[model samples]
Target: MSLATLWALGSVGDRLRVAYRLLSKDLDMQIETTAVIRNVQKGTASGDLTTHGLEFDQLDPAQQMAMKAFVFDRQDDALEWSHGAR
Candidate 1:
């Protein structure tokens, strides 16, 4: 469950919200609405950027991993697989 996978799955918004809540109170991340959208688009188009916020540098390893997992988990449930076993 990587950030790139989440963005590709169109779940960046959810992950961003979670990360914002987890870090906003302790860090300086503001979770800019427009910036989040722009970052998603950029990540999708260029695939060069790893993160989209000023606070990304401040997050610890655990927080980063948690955010990635959150996004992946949400996306995992949203996907539909017709051939998979129920």
Candidate 2:
């Protein structure tokens, strides 16, 4: 996964909007900050994702879908990774 993807995965909220400042280190990794969207709907709750000063195309499809699904389901523990052996 890319840094952008990691950042998106770490995001938590019904509606998510992120603004990332790409530093030199990020550029070294070929990561760029543009725009991201996360939309979710569950029961009587609905959320949206938006980013400022960023291009939407910068986000990966999987990351986008993951955000949407997470928001829609109102779940934040869907993809937890254990540090040690299971």
lDDT per residue as tens, model 2, 1-86: 12222123423233234454322311212233344334322223234332222235456765565445545443333333333334
Model 1 lDDT-worst window of ten:
29-38
Local accuracy by lDDT, each model: 0.41, 0.36
Candidate 1 residue lDDT tens string, 2-84: 24332333334433332344232224332322113224434445545454332243456665665666666555545644334
- Give per-residue lDDT, candidate 1, residue 62: 65
Point to the candidate with the largest TM-score.
1
Which pairs in model 2 have colliding backbones? 34-54, 34-55, 35-55, 38-49, 40-72, 41-72
Q: lDDT of candidate 2?
A: 0.36
Question: What's the lDDT of the predicted structure labeled candidate 1?
Answer: 0.41
